[model samples]
Target: MIRIFKQLLMTTLSIGLLASIVGAQGQQTVEAASDSTQATIRVDKVDNLSSDFIMGADTSTMISEENSGVKYYDFDGKQSDLLTILNNNGVNYVRVRVWNNPYNEKGQGYGAGNADLINAIKIGQRATKLGMKVLIDFHYSDFWVDPGRQVPPKAWQNDTVDQKAQAIYDFTSNSLKTLRDAGVDVGMVQVGNETTTSGICGVTGNDEYKLFAKGTQAVRDVDKNILIALHFTNPDKTTTMLNYAKGMAKNKIDYDVFATSYYPYWHGSLDNLTYVLKTIANTYDKKVMVAETSYPYTLDDTDGETNVVKTTDDIKPAGYPATAQGQAHALRDVINAVANVGPKALGVFYWEPAWTTVGGTDRAANLPIWEKYGSGWASSAVIGYDPTVTTSTYGGSQWDNQALFDAKGHALQSLHTFKAVYTGVNEQLPDPMLSDDEATIASLLKNPSFEETKMSDYQLTGSIKLAQDTPKTGKNALNFYGDTDYSADASQTITLDAGTYTFSPSIQGGDTNASSDLAIYATINGQTKSVKVAPLTGWKKWLKPELTFSIAKQASVKLGIKIKSNAKSWGTTDDWILTKIANSDTDQSGSSSSQASKTSEQSASSESDTLASSMVSTKSTKNDVSSSKRDKTLPRTGEKVMIGFGLVGIVMLASVCVIYFKHQAS
Candidate 1:
């Protein structure tokens, strides 16, 4: 009877261990099937359309004195209105600046095209009639408002903080009301121009918030439909810009858009602009727009005015030459970067693209008025100006080289780039070497192979190196290692639509003695699921590990690669590719069979039990062991634990026999 009881115990333990293994495999199979079903449902609903991206230009001086004789011409040299040419080239919006009063005390115009309210109204009317949207920029000063100078309006310079706030509110309301009454379709309004000095009203801290709040309220009162924008300079100044937005939120200053000026020379590279735009759009939940941007079409000056951006220091961004083609490429890249920031990127407006060198004067038309009231601000405003020079012979526009039109008033190639619709897929920049399929793939990731010196898209942790000696394909591969458990990892966040995707990477262990275990972890919907890659045996060859999965909704997924154990060397990975699986590869009827095959592969190896144990041990070490302790009332599934239990069962059975024998002796 004791022998029979021992046999029964052994059978029960074996059956329980097999059941646990089968159960775990079944759970994985069910999850894969569910993901496939969700993907199929989502793929049927994908939509492809042109993104609602804004293509605009700031033509503040278009109707001013300096542009009095300007005329735009097409490639064929046919003369036309500047607005007509822009509209024909697919410009959908126009931005005009409004100063409090550009004229001097004696009523003589400051001669910089007289950017007053009346002229701004005329520009707005023209844009509206041409079926283009208008953005009213309120400088809220008699002259310019920039980082160096944000002087209050000449009439309000002596007012207190409270009084200034009230004046801003009244000025904003009255200006917007006048534009609306004049039948200008004011789609958006900028509250202040480069309000980075102190605040919009030249005050600090909460007082600035008060000014912004009042200005925003004034616009809303005039027309709630018009979007309100707060403008600043330098996209690379992320901390300053973000803090301003945060302060506005804390004080309940409601605005719809956050705008910035990004001249590559002053602000940084296109990549820097992209990062700033993405950060602001994600953090503030507000639409982002490049209110001002420009590039030179030629290095040669067409006028006598000293060119501000002619020096090497002023042409900072690499790869963009001071030529017509380079200008087109640079502008295209900027627009593409903004569009890639998702739907929150409304659009970009080229600053004063039509402010040409046509009617420029050798000297100020009203020198006495400029000196007395404006303090000779216009002459000094030109780039590369020498203060010691007395004569105002600053011939033509300093920004003529940066304009969309040449001196002959012919439209440059850059103007045509704006007509290309932003599809949010392949960018408009020229890449002659890329094939059709290569272009499609390249559009998915900017740095796919980790060959680029700057790893802008990836974040690395632990011991990481870019190995070149034994790469799989390219000249470089990512090597990650650490002596601590699961310390080596690389991750990147990507925005993807709901669909099936395949992640394939060429991998190899450093040597036979290295930790060969690798796993790909994908965090989606706040939960992490991991797929194991085959352990590498040697560094002689590379193995391709592929994982196919699906997402149910559009989200930013964090894809990571990690080593599972501690060793002298972890491994190397190269030619990593993650792309959406073609629909033809996924058949609804074959999904179940595919899942079954995957389950079989997972359990086919003799080391399957060891893998299970490793997973369980890692979890126990990281989390509370008591939370998932095995059920002692049932048979144990772990190999070592089960063997010990079997021995105990036999010992108990032997004790039972001994007790029976002792009773017989009695």
Candidate 2:
């Protein structure tokens, strides 16, 4: 009887084990399935932290929460303006951008862009006055922030890296203090608009870490405890993002939270955000926030102009209105999507919610930062029309339409939806991830393009034969004949060793209209010089530019050539020349005989000069290919080559002369 009972128990145990396996597999399959749908999202287990983010909504719904409900007294309108309702419901923060020097030299203040310190102060003051937490966003530039086109502010040019970093730090700390001084309680301060990704400060291809570290350090030094968020534009590559964070941490840099800018129009739907947030938060063990986010309310252009029109197709969901009601719904939905990510999800900041219609006040209109493609403007401001009574021929009040409150500052019916979203009590919507089964959402968090492939050393050779264009590589490479134009093909490396060399692409004055001239230039030590080449025809082996430049004994240099066409139009011929030669011999250009006789004398003199002079340019600076060391002396705009000699060749020849004199004494 005991043996029989044991057999039955074994059978029961086997069935139970099989059921557990099947259940686990089913859950995985369900998640995989949701992956196939656009709205389906997935969550990765990074931490056991509960993700209970506030899903506050922003409502630009025109006039009162129940504006539509009260139609002919059909229903009572909801109380409050959309934004206020969201704030009351649970929204924790609001972000706004401030532009610097938006006014032209004329001082005739441009529109809302002049959110100079004074303007920013007012906005912060108003937001705090309403008891809402304000976030100060420094655009770094007077415009937008993104991967492409993050030109530093114009005035900051010529400043050293330290100077620039300090400037940013001062601007941030001071601005934050200013807001606080004005009785405006600023909860967060974004050091730079969006630098969470790779291109933070050190000028992309250069010492990115060094430069960014300085700024990041500077900001922290100002207020160690303030929540410092590193904002990134892409969420897909958690590894890449983590790599950057690790690099910073290795250097002992500290930041409180990680933030990202995600727009479904560009990033994708709900699933993408959830995966990015959870993965990055768990990986880095830091808080996460959607620092800057937005969506168009309608497909219609308020001004009735097709060019300025916003389209749902530009994003998705095809029929979203350009109307107030449409915008309010879209706003509410996005907030809910972010909140569902869980615990580390602090909240979302609606960018420029009060960007109202003020004449000449469009940020993207006059500011190149906001302009996309053509000049018509890609106005992303929420407030669609003007609240002020002032009128303009350009439909000045267009932006005021997106404002949460009506023209009279009265609450709109859409406010009810915003409040519902924030309270988190509306409904426990089914997990967007639970419905997903496919894992495609993983793609959204992919890394930005990385050149993981190793590079190989190789030589690229070609010539600017008489009429053909020869591309120039290094600043020291020579141009042959009378050709001066050269294009740098995508991949080629020209290396220069310490020595004196001459390079010049010349041209014979043919048709008086065809008076073309060629000049070669070189950057050595820390200076550049150019020299005229004796004009010659194709491969005129006879004309050797008498170039004699002394490259510091252990220094490297780059070569370039400037082509001149005295014709009605410059560069009409479209041809260039390239040549490279390394001269390690200390001999003068006079040849072998000269070298043997003067070697010793030249050596002694060079020793003297080297001892007396501090390491000139190339002063132990690393020559990383990605670096951009602006020769402060390099003409801001390309300087016109005179006769045929440019600054580069002249400097090279002068150095050669100095070395020649030393050779004579030896």
Query: Which portions of model 1 show Cα errors greater than 4 Å?
Result: 1-51, 65-67, 359-396, 421-666
Evaluated at residue 584, the lDDT of candidate 1 is 38
Q: For every model shown, what is its TM-score relative to the native structure?
A: 0.54, 0.45
Model 1: per-residue Cα lDDT at residue 7 = 70
lDDT of 2 by residue, 85-202 (tens): 4455445555656555544444533343444567667655655666776666666654444543355655675677667767777667676667768986666656565664225432
* Poorest lDDT segment (10 consecutive residues) of candidate 2: 443-452
The model with the greatest lDDT is 1
Cα lDDT over the full model 1: 0.64
lDDT of 1 by residue, 497-560 (tens): 8776666666766432445567777778788766777656554246665556677668888776
Compared with the true structure, model 1 gives a TM-score of 0.54
